[model samples]
Target: MSSTTETFEQYLHNFIESDWLSAIHTLLPEIHEVDRNAVQIWFRFYPLSLFRYLQSAEDLEKAVQGFAMLGRYELKDQIDTSHHFLYGHRYWKTVKAAIEAEAVVFENDDIDLAEEIRQLAAMSAEKLKIDVSLVIAIAAVGMMTLNQTGLENFKNAADGIQKPTGLMAKSPDKIVSERSKDDSQGVFGFLKTVNKKYSIIYDEKRNDGRFAITSDQEIAGASALDRSQNWQEKDSRCWEGVIPVECLSASCGTCWIGVIAGQEKLSEVSRRERKQMKVFGYNQPEGERPFMRLSCQAKASGNATIVIPPWNGVFGKKIYQNVQDVELEPATTSARELRKVVSEAAINKAE
Candidate 1:
């Protein structure tokens, strides 16, 4: 298994085996009070998130309401109100234990005991995803109650993982597959059958496109394109004056392409590809899977269609920096001239 897949599986296994299970079990009495269907749906997508929150929660009412908030209000209304009351009651039981054990402290020690009951009612706001915005909102509420600077530290922490775009979107695999199929048929109809069986597709019409492999295939020798001399002529279209490749190694990202279809079908990512893709800036977010890859590095055993990027260039970092500088350049000519003079002076001093 690829390290990425192995790491994910290990994470899941560790969570299952650790104190997380004990924490969830402790929540059973409270969880039972929630609408059975709502609880089931919430657990499906957010078992880990809920478990983590429960283990850390300062109060029981807040903990129970937190999980309930994961479900939409419209759906919650469909369930029995008795279930909701029971859910709240059970959650508070755990919260009272946490407070008694000194796991979480309240800002106002003097507040009447009834305030704790009211706090649970306030926690039913239905924003899920537990993203930066949610974290910021929680901090804001804490600051309002505590009259302190806790929100600033929380904001700084959230900023580290925030994306340039607010949306946490992933590329659709089916769309990629369809594009690969269209491109392959348009360029190399005769090679379709062979290309389908293997993960890589070669198109001579585009930049002398050579072999394209799926992300997961194990390459023999140096790279995926490397083949024995006997099979080289028969397997490689470049040998038949079809698609030409200058270098078979990653030195040339020439074989870069968008995964047309079946990204899941491709091999799980490797350490080398992960590093190289970052260097190339093809994969921007740390959490995202790369959509483009070097064909020579990626090997596919199953069917996948791919579309080649128009051009390949090394020195990706320099290109990215230059683009950013230009975009941020001052609008006035005077500012531009001053910037240019300062840049020249810095260069001369370095030399």
Candidate 2:
């Protein structure tokens, strides 16, 4: 068997986009479009740098503990389900169990990870009553779990942590169908100026997650929520709406949402949006419109679905302290003060 170190770094490196994309294509006919996007988003969100950071750590516990956002996120255990915010997460436990059983029975050191996952996916399909696509994605998660925490921890199951609801629990088909829903009858919509109305499914438990954006110009943040619902029942400060928003201007970072589907429908990520996301330590990579976005800044022109992270933090300077060339644009009073602190630290190092 490959050492845990080899297995962990192997997938992060050579597995590459093409490898997973290849799997996505092979399973396209069997997997729902939503589940396919979930795989793509999972790969994007859990970056290679994260794995390298963990792998190269002299002390794993310290590395995890010293993380800028440590304790801010509930990802202490079940390393495999780190991407659970994506769709089809409900199938993870079943898929991981089956994969573990196979690994034990074979004890094959030269195991082809991809082929092994594919075969396990096929075998679980009949019993799980779920699509092969989802099983395939979750199986990959199982492999990652094994590589990250070993089989002993993988089998223990996560305890006491409460995962997000709605999309994680729903079937892929139902999640995808949400995007096609519309209720817009606006003059511009009827005239084909824009999609009449786009539904934003944030949480699907009892329809608390779904909302209609009738106006093409409306941003999917606090303002939109207020327009759609009566905020009188609860304080609109935060978590009062389907998508929480502390500052509708993207300064607070509370409105960031992961694009589960329909990312193309959302407006392009602005320079300001990119800056805020970086300072918020949500997503630091550069892309025209990343899977991670500030809901206060993204306006939808078509149907879309998104996942609201259970937590948010402003730790960009700490997280990307070593990253060079990327200039950070500070927002809000607190973030600007944070910049000053970082600047002082840099000056101290130079001295």
Instruction: Show the colliding residue pairs in model 2.
Output: 203-209
Find the 10 residues in a row with the least total lDDT in model 1: 159-168
Model 1 misplacement above 4 A: 1-196, 199-244, 281-289, 321-351
Give the root-mean-square deviation of each candidate in angstroms.
Answer: 21.6, 6.0
Q: How well does candidate 1 score on lDDT at residue 326?
A: 16
Best by TM-score: 2
Candidate 2, after superposition: displacement of residue 22 in Å? 7.6
Task: State the RMSD for candidate 1.
Answer: 21.6
Q: List the residue pairs that clash in candidate 1.
A: 60-91, 60-95, 176-260, 176-261, 177-260, 177-261, 200-212, 214-300, 216-267, 217-299
